[model samples]
Target: MPSAPPPVPPPQPISDLPHLTRSPPLPDFFLAALSLFVFLSSSSSRSFKLPLLCIQSNPRRFLKTPSMSFSHPNSGRTPHDAHRLHPFASPQSLSDWLKPRLPSDSFASWGVKPGTKNVHNLWLELSEGETSLADSTPPIRTVQVLSLRIIDNHRRILLESHQQLSDGTLRNRNRPLSEKMKPNETPESAVYRAVKEELGSILGDSDCSEIVKIVPDSYKMKIEERNSASYPGLPACYVLHSMDVLVEGLPKEDFCTVEEEEYANSEESSIADEAVSVKKHFWKWVSLDSLDF
Candidate 1:
């Protein structure tokens, strides 16, 4: 059968066909050119964007420089001043800087209570990542304080002595009668509140109302100073509103007063009455000439 047509060479496998056999390897340049052509064709037809690759000798030189200036509506600080002041230049900056340094909870852990309405509390809240005081008036870093210059007929000034017990040791210092101005509280109201809170145990309500008198326009002065003593490293401005006060019913000589501080059993304790300990505060009267004023 004609040798069966050479066994008809069972249909040659498609992969084994002559044209399908591997050809000579392409030149490296030719293969690269073909790849570029294909890439350009695909890129022109595609709707997607390709990220631009910029080759720079100095990458840092091409990088954007961070701004050194900050602006606040109420603060008239210049850019140079802001740069120098740094984090204290703006409320947001101050909050950002203080957040990591201050305690997350109340200031009681710091051995003092700045009060519920104190500006330090506001800063603490802001540091806690709250935006409530972002648009409030007077800025967050500006602390308003009312200092009472209580004088007697002998010209002796009433100064409160603070003694804090830390690690079983007592640290003492003396300061004038002062309180932070509460939110929306007037200077006059703050003065009265401070008097009551500090002298309530010594003087009766009727005596406070009848005997205590704030001198009219008595050398009132407002001054701003950096507060380095209260919260160390806290870049805060203290706006002191000082006024002269006259109280008729106090000891002419130095006297001691104890303020009982009740703290919670734990740092996370929520119960208001779960007191674990008590701390005392001592007060006295000193001659005005003795202070540096």
Candidate 2:
């Protein structure tokens, strides 16, 4: 009788049960949208490709801009004005403009006439007051020079003597064969021209390729020096390009070569009025260990 009484109690509703509450079932449309979203996400992950990012370890290895082109303001000016001084405001501005142009192949190929004055020569004119620095301040100048470390199979470096004055003293320190780079000239072109000009007497009329080989991807350095000895009181920047040149069949002993240099009789003389001065260049090949520089 007691067990039948206990079983008589009715079952309690889920909403009325202790610690229990009824929850409405999720709508069909909501469930369907959720399933569709998950399915599309899974499919897209398999079907689409993500773009990859490449980072360069060395930022200097590439230029930031895709292409850079500069046109000289006096490119199309008359011949008289072509040689006129176009001074840069500062050393940084000059460096920025000249760096890219240093590797250019040719101005004529680009349909521009080459100016008479390169940076070095222009500085001479400006510093001498042959032409005004105009409204530009910080009248700094830059020069691009190409130097060659001519090496033979023996690893001996070739060096050339400085200009010998008539008074039997050297005008400057002995250094490697070098040349001031011309406007719109490539380093390769400047190398070829320098070798041909400096070593032509030794190499004869033979092609430069037959006599020497330029080592590719050689060391590069840039140095800024103030108060050049040549131009006193004037700050100068030297953008030097040094390259290794492999030469063949050169004399092991010392030798001599003659180079003709032109000088203005007076500070006011024009290019046409320059006087030619012929001087002898003494050359020697020394061991790498014995070299001071």
Candidate 3:
């Protein structure tokens, strides 16, 4: 009469911070549907996963905060026009659409190409209601954190700090590249901007593209609770996103020459400086095994 051991207990709901694992491949439509459900049901404070159909190793590059607003990257098209061009049903038509067909004028109007930008937008659209839900609750703070990974041939990683260079190796040195998210900027875009600011002259247009291999997933998400000096009394939640970056075309020695020859103060310098300027920072490469816990 024990009711068959309480029917084996209902499966527990997935934890807000689920174990980090490679998400398995799922049907595109099913994945989309699941993402929509999570977005609509969860509060803004909670971290949710959007279906990542594209799998890659080293997917843990978690993008930090900023209330994301999705729009077309290409110019000349209104948001509505962009939406019309890239309807969910059309791009996801894994059947006929995937097959090549004769070119037609209609093809040109199909909208902006699917990339990181719109994919984020799609997540927003699914979870649009969460914003209102959040409005009803006590306010939660948002922070955007950007990080850069500089690795050497021995597989050691570089750690940077703004602290005095004399602090020595005992003190914690954070990964050098980090910045708050700017208005209407994506995490990856923001990271690139910071890179240019930090090492533009040395990098010399060499885009960092090679990423290390890790569990494959669409996006990396992490949530933590902590207190900071700026807002000591108030409790806080931290959302973190990080990615490994490898710069192509960098020479093995003398990363880049910094010429002391100063340019004359002129109109060109003023204009050029506005776009990109060197930032002051320090770097130290440490072996992965040598990190003091």
Candidate 4:
């Protein structure tokens, strides 16, 4: 008797397959600090707005005008707040709802509704270990990044620059601390790691009375590759989550600025040196009133 054909194996998800992706390396602590200083100084001292560019992803279609701010005034719900209330908040929610539905009834099949174009901004890119059924082009990736606006007890905000800026270009600036969240990491935990990684042991002593306060409210932005030339092919989408954090008891001695270095000796730099064109990072603290945005 002919035996039945060997049982077919279940197809594995794409993430299970090997894939290659590249990201800039974290600079040395000194260089990172210096870059932060340059960013804060240039940003605060100057008045310039970063230009938003529309991308033409499809060669057959013309690029539409870019609209700043995904502010949905009618909903009156911030993205973070609305996210929790969303029925499709998790893959399970989507699966449970989609399992019985016909493929033709999918959200994409429904033509975009008027004034609802901004809805796409609400969909977050896949996070680490999160899988999607959607097809992905090689090298194209989605990364979750965190941005912090650190307010110390003195009511000052810390700012840093990780990107090198041209003489007159608006600063590519961020908070003194921001990082990609690790797998299984919560936003609050990610912020704490960022502080420890960037600020060192100042907040770690047993007698330290410093208080770290996190604002429950958070903001997010979806940045497309076409919008910024810096990130070329892969990492096509950057989902930035912004937080306002407060920490007390940061001593005055630990507060200082990093000087920008024009060049570096590659022989001694870290492996991350191979991934970036700019080698410097700077940081500074500015009063709360100094923030214009």
Candidate 5:
């Protein structure tokens, strides 16, 4: 008799990670709706197809401990405003609003004629109450222009954005940018400068890595006005920008966060460093396939 070979380790659960794939939307939304229903109704965390409408390609999910909040490259929005958004606007409608007519109530696409602030607001809402996320406060607008960089485990290109983080989180960065410097510049331009100063590489230079896209990833935000002395702007905007990319070399300590203090930094209460900055959210880049969509 012969002995059997050693068994292999189980595959990693991609359910909490995002993947890179360019696949067609499951057969028409109509047919997918049936599958969507069961997926949502079932106890399993996997996303369903249509009616339940849980279509996310990446599966990695983060709990958003204070260190993560992003925004569109425009005037920011309020938490009440996010929760108060009109129900008529579907994800498709919201995505459409970004391209053309970004209304006041919605965040319009960035770099557009009038503005796309609110059009991007609804975009943030789509990521709320998702499979693995806990209930979060409404999103907030950032006061400065932001520049976001995405890199793979090898520091390869992923995605980028020009929007800024709200003042509350700006102070959470490895190094804070001069908020007063770019008073009139657009967020994209402002971000480009900031990235250069912090990381010491010009993104637009011929030597820089090519950026895939700059998307205004929407996620729900929770906010409340406070009488705190720190956040000059008492009621600051909080946001989470979801960048799709490939990157590496991110040590958790390279970034700063107030996960232990956000809930307590209210009007009557106080947080030590009143000013929190966010140069990076420090994402855990697992293969998109690790996500269980």
Candidate 6:
């Protein structure tokens, strides 16, 4: 009977297959740092309003529309507070619920809701190993990416950009930091790719640490939580890895500015005068504590 087809292997759940691991040439320090990501919450509702995020696998119809939840950073998570989620805050509790244990379903300390969307296939593969406590211990959910934008060589802006691709554009994307990555492209690779795409250069093996600011003005939306089982039993919110990239030898191009043609200047004369394109000066970082919305 064809030997039952040799048991037909089990489907490799995306979560089980790790992406960023401690491997060759990358040095042990960088590998360790990959574990402790300084990611802020996604600025869901307050700002960065968009309609969709593209998905790679199903290019035809895998676009992620701006869920009402994703657009509002102030919406969920109960009264858990912000500091605990992002390095942007102090620890928490009602005065007594504060001990730690293995990475069991009990990790829902922040009151992160469970997975309802059933997002179970999105996989993350790393070349590094779980060398430190942080990498091996903390949950792996959304990732932290670092972008050091350079303008004219003297200035720098630690920018963050992620566009949920249109179904057909998921694999292509406005900033496909996660795709087209090399063999071991974990969060670190995402950072490098983001820099290369935006700046067009090579990032020689270097360690960048001084984070000038946290983009999106808050540690609210970047949080990686799913209302689905794909990443089930995982931390409702897993902090991805981030970095402090340098903006050495900046450029003159304005990536974030609204081109004069794309703005609201409907008047013909207004259009002509506003033709002088003004670049949006990106900031280094924003303290997570100050954000109101």
Question: Considering every candidate listed, which one attains the maximal TM-score?
Answer: 2
Predicted structure with the largest lDDT when compared to the true one: 2
Superposition-based RMSD of candidate 3 using all C-alpha atoms, in angstroms: 26.2
Q: On residues 1-293, what C-alpha lDDT tens digit does candidate 3 reach at each position?
A: 65555557666566533674556779999999999888877877777565879769764332222344435222343333323332234223411331233133223322232111122222222122111111112223345455555556676665654322111212233654554443345556655666655556666666543322222332344666664222222234555555555554444543322322121222233322322122234555567687652
The TM-score, computed over Cα atoms with residue i paired to residue i, of candidate 3 is 0.37
Q: Which is the better candidate, 3 or 6, if ranked by TM-score?
A: 3
lDDT of 6 at 256: 35
Off by over 4 Å in 5: 1-142, 145-149, 153-181, 201-233, 238-293
lDDT of 1 by residue, 197-241 (tens): 666666655446667788888746575656334443334556677
Better of 3 and 5 by TM-score: 3
TM-score of 6: 0.23
Q: How accurate is candidate 1 locally (lDDT)?
A: 0.52
Model 1 poorest ten-residue lDDT run: 61-70
C-alpha lDDT of all candidate models, in order:
0.52, 0.55, 0.40, 0.45, 0.33, 0.30
Off by over 4 Å in 3: 1-66, 70-140, 163-173, 204-219, 229-236, 249-279, 291-293
Candidates in order, TM-scores: namely: 0.49, 0.51, 0.37, 0.38, 0.23, 0.23
The clash tally of candidate 2 reads 0
Candidate 3: the clashing residue pairs are 57-214, 58-214, 61-242, 62-241, 62-242, 63-241
Once model 5 is optimally superposed onto the true structure by TM-score, how far is the C-alpha of residue 276 displaced, in angstroms? 9.7
Of candidate 2, the 10-residue stretch with the lowest lDDT total is 61-70
What does candidate 6's lDDT look like per residue over 45-91, in tens digits?
A: 44434389876874332111111222343444321221122221112
Over the stretch 1-293, how does candidate 5's per-residue lDDT look in tens digits? 89998999787676544684456666778677887677677877676454666789855433332212224334353333333333324445644533332233323223132212222322332222111112222222233223244444443332222223333222222212322112224444544343444333322232123333334552122333342122121233423222232222334233322123321322212221232323333223233344331
The lDDT ranking, best first, is 2, 1, 4, 3, 5, 6
TM-score, ranked from best to worst: 2, 1, 4, 3, 6, 5
